[model samples]
Target: MSTFQLPSSTATTSTAYSSDEEDTLPYPGELSRSDFLAKDFNPEAYLSSLGRNRHQTLEDLRSDLRSRSQLLNQELLELVNGNYEEFLSLGADLHEGEERVEGVRVGVMGFGREVGGVGKVVREREREMEGLLVEKRRIGGEVGVGRALLEVDARLGEMEEGLGIIDRDEDEGDGFDEDDEEVGGEKGSSPVLRRLQRHTREFLLLTRMVERVGSSHPFLLAQQGRVDAIRKTLLLDLAAALRQAKAAKEADAMLGIVRMFSDLGAEGEGVRVLRGS
Candidate 1:
């Protein structure tokens, strides 16, 4: 028998879209159509698997070992070059909190930027919703109740529920300060903080839903606008509360709080407090 090499399969599951094809990127918290069509597309599960896997493949295992060995060799070379005592002295300095004294972490502001980005998305969704309502009003008279309209109504209801959660959050009547010592507990322990976080989460979830539904749906777009408006109004109310506190002769307390917010990179929030004052 003659030995022969088999031809490759005609199907190309691994190849990406052709270069000539126009590429489309996904919006935040969204996946591209290609991602949905992928055989393995679960991002959370993929991340978990990578975290759990010591060696995902032979190549991965080899690469990891090589990296560790190279690091060891570098460390040994440094020690031979009389850097070991220097490293030891550096470690002792860190133990005495010399590294922590720099205080650079206070101005990072990464989390504030993330929250601001979310707030911007929420505002954009609100504008989209206004356009949707205009469209719905335009077409409502011509076309009566239909399946598409019903779907829009359902999405609108979900958006309403999301907003309602934020409104009802204040009904608890705890009246806690924004910088209250009581609300500074560990994650999930402080009721006031939890409520605030929940409100943000709801906004984020609704924002994602609106994006997924697309800007075509008018009711959703309008509802999103309402949600954003409500959140801004709520924040303004907080600013007003700060103003009231200052009026009540809590200047010493309010000033410190406002300054703390500013130092923590929440300059907008600090401005709001001062404006309220």
Candidate 2:
């Protein structure tokens, strides 16, 4: 083996790499090459993505609004329909009650005397009054129906206003051009609109009917009152006859008068005839 000269430790230190070599390595805090490349990404592409997101959000909002609108409309319709039924029922009840009262009035009139003939006349008048009252009640019912129709119309208007707000929002999102105009114009004649229109027309007709009938009822009631007054007068006359007479003949005459008045009051035939007029 040939003996070689050993390198000294001082020589190895003298050939050391510079600090610049350390600078070439990436630091833990520094960005990677990929991160730097991604820094100048396209803003337009990002914005387009955001726009898509917004579109989806708007669509969701519209769907929610439409659902809410439908629910509200259904509830409103039910309420209006219920109100109409209640009013109609009330009016019928009133009519029936009035009829019963008139009958009772006639019965009371019949218990009087006949000698004066006043009792008979009063009973006839009461019968006429009952008929007039019936006619009046019928007319009143018509008026109530008309009022119910008007209420429904008013509710429809309110729902339309709410729908308008949603329409405005949609218009803002999608520019309303000629196509939109065409759609809107045609929508007015759609099946749903047609149905609503039919309902409105029916309501209007009912209202008009009520107005016509209402005008006649008060007059009829006035006539009825006159007949009632006559009945009351006859009742008074019979009562007087009952009190004044001691003789059986006088009592018999009074009884005949009472019977005549009772017959007249039976079903308010006179009142019915007046009402028919």
Candidate 3:
């Protein structure tokens, strides 16, 4: 008790400050460090704002700071004096403090258990979301395949509806020479032959798309019979067009259809053309 003495407030108030604490120091907007430390403080903008807000002179600012410092010192001194006896006996009063500490530890342990349970629920929900996302992607892929199959079916239907209009009767005639020329090079070709060539090209394009989808794709495999029937129909129309060209003695037209069969790698059909059937 003899070793401890209260600090003198008069001496504290009289203590000299560091050189930087002097009011004559140059600072941005002549503001104190406490003002610069304030929330949302922007020194550049605050300095700019000071031009329009210079109501408080430097002398007034210094007076207000000095008075606030004195008030804080007085309050601190009063607080210390009022609690001096209890502050001295603080070590003796901490005898039952360990029980309070144990109670706080138990509360923290209970809170940790609750947090752990919540974490487990969050992880479980994350796993479920991942599974649902994978299933959604799979269903989306199947839907895309189904739509492609519908397009193939629609095109085949159009080809079937147009099949009976082609002149199949005039195809029984003498065979033409199996010479080659591009169909693209000929103008003034027969309209019936032109339509047949266009449908053949379109059917081949559909075949390519189906092949790219894969041979064993379930959607393609299911429609394989209809696809094959359309292909056979295109081939028969091509054969008939070759004979009709021979009947009309359109030498250029026969040459173009012969070239088409060659490009198709169907030399057997070209052989039938040479055989007059």
Local accuracy by lDDT, each model: 0.54, 0.48, 0.70
Each candidate: RMSD? 49.0, 46.2, 22.0
TM-score ranking, best first:
3, 1, 2
- Model 1 agreement with the true structure over 196-251: per-residue lDDT tens digits: 44444444555555555565566656666665664564355345545765687666
RMSD of 3: 22.0
TM-scores of all predicted structures: 0.26, 0.19, 0.51
Model 2 global lDDT (CA atoms, 0 to 1) = 0.48
**Candidate 2 — which pairs collide?**
113-238, 114-254, 114-257, 127-268, 127-271, 128-270, 128-271
Q: Which stretches of candidate 3 lie over 4 Å from their true place?
A: 1-104, 165-187, 217-219, 247-252, 262-265, 275-277
Residue-level lDDT of model 3, residues 1-277, one tens digit each, is 3776457875565554444366656543434547756899985787566645666665776676587678778988999887886776774566567678889999999999999999999999999999999999999987877787777767666665556423334644212222333255356766665666666676777787787667698877887887777767767777888888888888888887887777666878977876886
lDDT score of model 1? Answer: 0.54
Top candidate on TM-score is 3
Error of 2 at 58 (Å): 99
Report the Cα lDDT for residue 207, model 3.
Answer: 80
